[model samples]
Target: MSNNHLTREELQDYVQHVFGASYLITQSARIHGGAQKVIYKIDCTNGFTCMLYVWDISSNYFQEEILNEPTFHSSYGSELFSLNTRFLAQHGIRTPILYDLNNDRDRHSYDFALVEYVDGQKAEAYFQHKNHKDRDELFQRIRDMLSNMHGIQRNVYGNANDNSKKAGPCYQVQRLDAETALSYASKHMKDIRKNDKRLLEKLCELEAAIQPRDLYNFIHGELGPDHIWIDHAMQPCLIDIEGAGFFDLEHEHSFLEFRFGDFYHYLKNNDLDPERMTFYRFCHHLSLISGGLKLLHRQFPDQQFARGLAEYHARCVVQMLS
Candidate 1:
């Protein structure tokens, strides 16, 4: 085990506290790909398995100076996770059941949660080898989930934990406004702009064409096959749902299209704001470029992958400008 991660004895203590003293930890392994938190899979002597999520500064890979920036949609902390979990469960969306948590510093130095260990493969991995029929069935269910999720509209925009209620019902908000997005993205677009001197102008032109809307639909903020799990029963379970909230449906669709690529058609909706789509499409790539660079600069464990992402999005941004 790494020095930053919990030791075997600590794991045993946590498992014993939650699953009863009779349950003993058989083994524990770290799950990769989480840049914000450390996740581990724990197997117990009683044949029980669960996931441990640890939120500490050591596990985070992003630049800490801007972690609290309002433009960042991802929420943290144990309370937000619990809130999002209940929010999804109330909507009949499938998600991991949170078993227990220790947010108080007494039990652990940092907040952590134990959730039901889903015995399944990632939807992204599952898609690679599945037959066409199986793929269709899976995509159909995913489309249904999208419909059910987007159908949930809130009077105001933002996450359920947001404290902007004083704005009252009928208040509308964008996940990231154009001005703020441009301000943040422009700083990172210098190299990209050099490729096309008028890049910023073109982006501004696209931004001006965006249409406005008042209704806010529930969105996963960051949804993709990787964040989805296919359990033993072949049902889809949404993971990393802390970013789920009420925002522009287009924001969610933009991410789905980017992540799912060619297969996105299966989940695409006929009615979407074309102008908003155009604008958000740029925002999406810009965010990735900034995020990827941030990760690389912060010396993320997967530096090569982060650099690849940054390069990929950088190319996409230049091409879009053209």
Candidate 2:
């Protein structure tokens, strides 16, 4: 397969293949700010709409070094999304239905999939415009959804695709064991070492203090309000679900706290291990530093936005150290 980006005609052909011979794309709009892949909103001749997900290196923001890192699986691929859709649905969680997936290397250099178009606004935007009472009701539903999702526990932690039978051996070990957590902390620290030695040192101190965990919860590894869609009927629909897995619940909460900011209290679990939260919070910022720097290094379209993200996290790291 040749390394070529999908043109409008190619995309039209793809939609026709999925929607049938007479199908035509009346209009298509590319979605912006997708760091790992290109997405398009396609409008077909008969008012049929769908989403196009194209996974190609050309649209990725991570540098080769970060992309090649075994521990960094930011771009897990279409298979995971398809698997997680069924998994999430089995738990009564909502997600857009996937229509088709294409991995034929001879036809294209990248993997792509067609998904049901969700006619809705992002949960973040939806939350912003809601009245106080409505907002409270929404949060109540969100809390329930998250509680149910995280309630699904496993003895061993890994990707959702991992076989349960094979997880028995690692049941005794925490996914975020001190050695593993500290090693990742140190690697991420390198990106910020020149900016703040004090924060770097504090990261080591924090990592050394992490408490061991025994149980793992199913989690959306990188959940943010933006990753949730509020359907026209006002139900929350999860997206960007390729990273769904079983891990320390604190890892998921840490990401929610940052992404949801002040709004996190409505969804926070009262029983979280405080020590795990603290360590995870620190690691979360470190990962942001690594991600932001990687975006900048790769010359992401919005250099200022990427730089600002890194700077904000750098400050958060300092505040945590203090």
Candidate 3:
């Protein structure tokens, strides 16, 4: 394994030792996405096909200090992905079935999960080729799935679990009201925008306008296009759920609009509170800007493109706040 890249021989050894399988490895293809995780499609001679996800623990894509914050889920690695999959499954939501998890200290220190491979086009691409009626049906199906997920109520808000042992009601992050959530974002923003007093004051005004309330529900924290895969039967399957948790339901709509630009217009006809949605959108944009800056600072401080991207996200936050 060179710099966390697994070679064919190493993968075969893992299959033999961990899985107790002597089947010859046929093919392994890497799938690229966000920098935090590495994915591979592995096919074996034993007629087994699976996708392997390896969390890049060594990558400073997200600052170590921010990720290690006590309020967030600590196991935002392979273990959390598996747990989130199980959580969604309990709610009748389809996700990639996790086959096995390997976290051995000696062999491979990084977390890894082997999951059933679902062969189909990504939902975004699938929707683009479909007729209007079919696209509407797909959107309805997605809406129903989101409704089912949000239907599952939770008493507290925040990370689903901190550890991997016990499943339900195991250990949740403390409930967060609007004030508390905004305060946390403010802390991060201070570091990202050190001397930008004008921008900081605008952020404070946005935070003050938020009305504190207790609303907790299951939220697929990162419900972006790439994570939604459409199967051959045209059913939606959710993947890459490292950020899933129990949180404010409004945040879900915020994420949906942020990731899918058209969602904002679609949701305008729905029974959602416009002001609340706007507030959540502001919060989400601020979080992304702060988090992106921290990642750039830690990993690519001298890179101009990286700095530009961070500035772009910050501009989005400013627009939302306005």
Candidate 4:
């Protein structure tokens, strides 16, 4: 929206007047991604450049103007972002550092936080541009990063559940049963219907017969190339922890495998066998497709998102049934 508006002197003055005189915003750089929140690139604290994440007020948001929670989800997202930075930093993981956080309910009802800007391009783009010739290094780095992240996740505040001990052939089956894919795919052709029923029944049977193990940790639920950023040095740093949550350790590597293949270029470099990699990839796609279906199925949900999910489900069913 009016990219010029972000750099306007008057608006900058208002923000400065409100945030106090400790730091000067040299320039305001707006990030794309409408609604939900407004993000900006600002110079903040101790001569370092950082970003400001802020919430935007919508006419119908905040629970129909009556039942909004005490704190906005963006507020929740930013605060959690700060904690995420803390967790990663404590473990020597390379990430954009958090400088400060502010939650203000005044004037349009907004919340904001400041964080260091990790200079780089999205990992997906970066890898392709470099031709990903160093495939082995990239795979090792990814594996090590997720493993380190999970090792620390073992100590976070929200990782309370233990679904690992139940890990068996049936665990995947049980998860597939709880998925919304059944309804979406069932309305399709003979092959899809047959596959869906067989999959669900197998999952239920697996859950009962398989004795699972506890693979505990808070996983970066959205583990994909898009959420990763590779710095000028070509090192990987994870981002977009909005979907982060406690999950099966097996699920930690799901997103990556879903978008890429199970016998992925990265895993092959790391020597992860095709059979094991396929399982990881399956669980990853299943969980995500499940979540997407649930959100899309919400009563009177976002039509745009629903249509997107519909296309995605069509692809997923084809992939699964095949």
> What is the overall TM-score of model 4 with all chains considered together?
0.64
Candidate 3 minimal-lDDT segment of 10 residues: 169-178
What lDDT tens digits, residue by residue, belong to model 2 across residues 1-322? 1113667788778888788977788877878787877788888788898888877765667536336654454436777888899899999998888889888867777788899999988879855764888778877787888888999987767777684544332312332332333344345555344445565566557655666555789999888998888887767888888879888888789889989988999898888877677877777776676567667767888899888877788678767865
- Each candidate's number of clashing pairs is 0, 0, 0, 12
Best by lDDT: 1
TM-score of every candidate relative to the true structure: 0.88, 0.86, 0.77, 0.64
Question: In terms of TM-score, how similar is model 3 to the real structure?
Answer: 0.77
lDDT of 4 by residue, 274-310 (tens): 4433444444444435444444454323656644654
Compare candidates 2 and 4 on lDDT and give the better one: 2
Q: Which stretches of candidate 4 lie over 4 Å from their true place?
A: 1-29, 33-38, 43-49, 55-76, 130-139, 153-157, 160-210, 262-313
**Model 3: CA > 4 A from native:** 1-7, 16-23, 66-75, 161-195, 263-275, 290-311
C-alpha displacement of 96 in model 4, angstroms? 1.7
* Global Cα RMSD, each model: 3.1, 4.1, 5.5, 6.8
Give the candidates in order of lDDT, highest first.
1, 2, 3, 4
Per-residue lDDT of 25 in model 4: 58
